[model samples]
Target: MIKTIIFDFGDVFINLDKPATLRELSQLGDFQFNNSIQDLNNQYEVGKITTEEFIRSYHNLLPQATEQQLIEAWNAILLDFPKYRLDFVKHLAATGDYKLILLSNTNELHINWIKQHISFYEEFKSCFDSFYLSHEIQYRKPNSDIFEFVLQEHQIQPTETLFVDDTKENTDAAQKLGVHIWNNNPKADDVIDLFTSKSDLF
Candidate 1:
């Protein structure tokens, strides 16, 4: 039985337009969504660099865009955090039957935007027993170490936890450690359906 739940933030609770930023950037230069970009993204998410430095990389690469334009382009991917999902998680958290954790691969800029735009950001956050942000924690998902860190920190048994993520690679990594998982399809699935869809686990 699952006594603990680890959820990925983007696509799991908050929606993301994963390609929006890339598409917007492509307009300014010959940007190949290649290793260089991925490397930079990884560094930013893990808090290896400051948000200014992260923004400067884009400004340097796409010289035509100003800092404001770059910041806007970078934040285009974030969308709304539906109220119903917030309600569902809050109710689940209130039950106190399962340990609730939110693990997200995100950077300061995105978080800052959420805090500014989402009115209930703090309230939503209070529901989690533990909240791990990649930038703050210096760890990102799809990496075995991050999953291991969470397990060790919470003193949780892998077999007794359920991890829900929108990405297959992330879920695959967690499953290797014996954690049951839901690789939620963002296009068709909603986090609000967690109880009904994964009823057997509950």
Candidate 2:
């Protein structure tokens, strides 16, 4: 029986236009932004750099842009959180059918943006038994260690925990640790459908 549900925040719950942000950033300066931006992003996610440092690095690259402008542009990836999904997750939590948890590979700037925009963040997060953030934990997704840490911390049997993530590699990593997973592809499938189909398990 699945007694626990793990959810990824970005893309899975909140919408993110990753490619759009990259494209916009690439056009910001005389120099071209390529795969190296991805490397910097990975480093930020893994807690190798602070948000201030990340913003400063970008500002240095794009000397023509102000710090505030660069910061806003960096956070442009976070679009909005739909109300329906928030309601659905709240409904699931209210039922008391499972131990809910949220795990996301998010950085400080993105988190601050959410705090400023998403009014229901506290309410939604309160519904979960635990909320884990990469920056806070100094660990990020697609890393087997992070998955193992959650399992160990919660004393959850991997087979009885279901993880939903937008990234394939993150899901794959959790699967390797024996957790049931759903790859939430917004273009193909929505999370509500997944919950409805797997209602019996909950």
Pick by TM-score: which candidate is best?
Answer: 1
Model 2 lDDT on a 0 to 1 scale: 0.87
**Candidate 1 regions with alpha-carbon error over 4 angstroms:** none
- lDDT (10s digit) by residue, model 2, range 15-132: 9898776666766776576688778887898788988889888888899988877877778899989988898899989999999999999988889899999999998888899999
Candidate 2 TM-score, true structure as reference: 0.93
TM-score of each: 0.97, 0.93
Worst 10 residues of 1 by lDDT: 25-34
Runs in model 2 with CA error above 4 Å?
34-36, 199-202
lDDT of each: 0.93, 0.87
